[model samples]
Target: MGLILGKISVETPKYQLILKTADYEIRTYPPSVLAEVTYDPALLGDRDGGFMILAKYIGAVGEPQNSRPEKIPMTAPVITHSAEKIDMTAPVVTSGGGGSTPITMQFVLPAKYARAEDAPQPTDERVRIREVGERKYGVVRFSGVATETTAADRAEKLRKSLERDGYKLVGEHVLARYNPPWTLPPLRTNEVMLPIE
Candidate 1:
């Protein structure tokens, strides 16, 4: 268990700009280290890996809106036994990996279910829909290159701070990156979030 810090915004954008920034931010960090606990061994396919696409919008909680296309970082998708037949693979890395090795991990949605819109399509696969429960989390705001070491360091500090504040550890550590990949490493904004009880 870790201490819970109050809310901290990671300079989130409202529309298509979000895709350019947030998506790049999420991909810049080491997803493998952050999502260690929920990583699914089965989903870790040969060479390629699996990931979960999470669509988040600003507005009332859970309200659906046709807002501009916003990009959010995705976690490796974790498939339950009922839908185990599907193949899970990691997202394609678009940038930031000139010489550095890309990290991989598994991601699990809470517990909901859904089918692919175009069912029976080889490329279209069934997916589970899960609602992220509301809970307190410790958040550390940062701006820089979301390297694996930096994310892990911030997470560790936030965890220690939360423990000092008497917050119980709840779930996995979440790294929210909010900068365009093209942005210089020192100018990027990244947030380290840890769910607490």
Candidate 2:
């Protein structure tokens, strides 16, 4: 019988822990690029469709479009709801009044290929590669599924904690997952990140 090798996880984006609170942390991350797709979940609610489309462009299910496309190592916590920073006491819930909002799913390109031009193009038109500039974040760590309710709740808690600590909010919250869906529930890693300035 042939040898069996389990899945290998690639390195996540580079970041430095800058501060810690009773329930959250402050981290700063360097600018990096990502391949993403923005779709109105109201119309395209099926999660698999968006994933498959982006996957194909990233060579997850098809041939790479670039000279070096070989299914760039998959990053953690496939983000279904993503962003950074804030204003006002309101959470500014972006769910578009309960499910009418657009969802932008993304895959963080590896450090070696973080530039948009350096990255592969998606065969599917729905997918596009873009760069994310460096920014500081207020992060809250949690376990279990990274669903909307969980993400929203953690985001509010993080935001409130940051504000309580005298940090000025600078951006929206981004949902980050570090493990595939199949990973054991208790072992999964999830974070809600908000920008600060």
Candidate 3:
């Protein structure tokens, strides 16, 4: 569904595909600007609250430089990762269960933004504009509802495949979802990604 949406209208992050296999793919992405927000799953009752905050910002709910809200185009693949402290050397395995830990959700800004400073400002301090450097990742794609359990399972599998391929995995595993909640589970596109050396 995400592939179809991206092809038809939605914009997705651009990456250079370095390798592909039945189980996973390795890709290198250029630096990009992102609008991100962190929320406590326990406090918010779920991840939806955090997502709504970002949605409103991009929906022109933010306070821009000109004092008027600027509407930014929505993008595909809303990316998420655990915001808790983890061992840098050890691979992160999400339990997929609700907890008190914080989760960070990010939306990749359009390429026209170029840099973090070029993006519209969010009235809510929780929403931050960050500039990420070029990164390489090993990603595993799956269909169906992207539960924490499902995302964790895929991430673990990708971690093993990347390690077996002689690639060193790093940071938290990232889960990318490319559809709205109403999308059918079977048609939804979800991907588990791990940063790699």
Candidate 4:
């Protein structure tokens, strides 16, 4: 599908929806590119603080070698990985800093730069281009507030439901948030996703 850009049309990466149930869906995402940054939870323990830094990095806030830095249109559902260990109190931070690993925030690159090699280089060391290969995932969809407990509970629910239905989970899970801070919790879109067989 072409996206309207001031009378100019642009095509974005096509994410295929394969199946859906009352609580979840399965999807196959095309090979895509992203720009990501890892943040220390001690410094950014909330969703707002980390998002602010990540947004600036993508926009090339203070990077010197970045001139004519393209304003890549932001896409829906920013993906974050905590890897393992969740703190119900710090749900939005992704990384609760219970361990040494930091949290990762990723912004999908526009289809114009579909391949990581074709994407403009991020001069900011904090930001780097990451090319992701096509992958299939099981996603549990939910609305209302996204607290640490809610995200964890939802992920567990998805895992149980998938297992009961004879699906095998092959990878760790991640959280995908689809709205800004200003979006009302009742209307915000969120998902708990894990790669599956």
Candidate 5:
């Protein structure tokens, strides 16, 4: 069954499993390039807003890249996190208030593009390409249609589990979904990830 899924699964960021507990797992991921877009959650309400922009960047919408249209293969999981105020160098800034936080959605580039420069530039300026350094995360996996409420609940669960194990969490919880919207709810794969010290 796993092999069958692997055959049809989209490319996901590579990670080494460092540890696993009953509730969650600790994994170390190497540095990788990502194509991302940011949007105001207060206005957009959900990831669909950012996902569409990144879909275009990755040619999922048949959009052209720099010069010629480069269609990059789709990858998983689609990562979403609330943009931190400190990282507000981009035009998208979030002022703390009622649901005004800006959310960033990222698509991990294929391994062939090891560096940010190696990846094709997005025609949309809103779509930024960045390289993140290697990092460790405590992740809790679940399957379902991940709504905001569900994701937040899972994140809290993951946080408690990590804290219980004496892990110092470093950043905001990240939600990653690995299947297209059309996938069956029970068959979909989703994860709530918290960076750890």
Candidate 6:
């Protein structure tokens, strides 16, 4: 596993400590898993939504045993292209949707990779996967199943806190899940993240 500097803090929305930074690893994918998946980045609105994701820090990268799902461990950092500050409150503009949004968003960075089924053949280097360099984020931690209602509730609370602190939201809230699907629902680790301006 690699070690990267992380800025740790405490957030009250979910009553848990938070760690934020850049240069950490993340595995991104197309929105195909959901019925509402869309490629038009514009479709990603200000509100939050449910997503099926498998995220973990680099330390946990490995093939699962007996074909069980792998347990990836995600750290407290984000990866971005540069160290420049971001405007969090600005909306993510996207091209209007056509019949179907292209599924070109599925690309994994150096520190992350998609599951075999979701990834292109190893030799297909045309996939646009690369490291994001440095990214700033605000993280709110919570335990239990990350249902839409629960995520929205926590996001609302965090949004209030961000506004109070004079931080504008940079993008839609991305929900990160850190547990296997078969795990007990009550013990899951979910995080709501918004880029800050």
Whole-model Cα lDDT of every candidate shown, in order: 0.35, 0.70, 0.79, 0.67, 0.78, 0.37
lDDT of 5 by residue, 1-197 (tens): 54224233678888999998899999999999999987775676654578888888778886655434678898898888777643312222123213567778899988988998888888889899999999999999988787777777787777788888899977777788888877777777889888898
lDDT of 2 at 46: 56
Worst 10-residue lDDT window for candidate 1 reads 82-91
Whole-model lDDT, candidate 5? 0.78
23-138 per-residue lDDT for model 6 (tens digits): 11222223221111223223443122112111211123344211234343333222111112323332111111221222122212223332334322222222222323234456
Off by over 4 Å in 5: 1-8, 42-46, 85-99
Q: What is the overall TM-score of model 3 with all chains considered together?
A: 0.88
Task: Write model 1 residue lDDT over 1-100, tens digit each, in one string.
Answer: 0101222233222211111222121112111111112223344432123232112221112332213322223322221111112111111121112223
| Tens digit of per-residue lDDT, candidate 2, span 1-197 | 11012132657887999988778888998988888887765566553336666666667666754445667766655665532222434343356224455567888888887578888666567788889888898888887766666777788888888898899987677777776667666667788887799
Ranking by lDDT: 3, 5, 2, 4, 6, 1
Task: Give the per-residue lDDT of model 3 (tens digit) for 1-197.
Answer: 54444332578899999999988999999999999988777777786557888888888344442213778888878898878766533333252136556788899989998998888888778899899999999999888888776777788778788888899876778889888887767777888889998
Error of 4 at 119 (Å): 1.6
- Where model 3 places Cα greater than 4 Å from the true spot, the runs are 1-8, 60-68, 87-97
- Lowest lDDT block of 10, candidate 4: 1-10
Judge candidate 1 at residue 189 and give its lDDT: 53
| 6: Cα error in model 5, Å | 11
Q: Per-prediction RMSD in angstroms?
A: 14.2, 4.0, 3.1, 5.4, 4.9, 12.3
Order of candidates by TM-score, top first?
Answer: 3, 5, 2, 4, 6, 1
Q: Please name the candidate that would achieve the greatest lDDT relative to the true structure.
A: 3
Pairs with backbone N, CA or C atoms under 3 Å apart (clashes), candidate 4: none
Give, for candidate 6, the lowest lDDT window spanning 10 residues.
Answer: 49-58
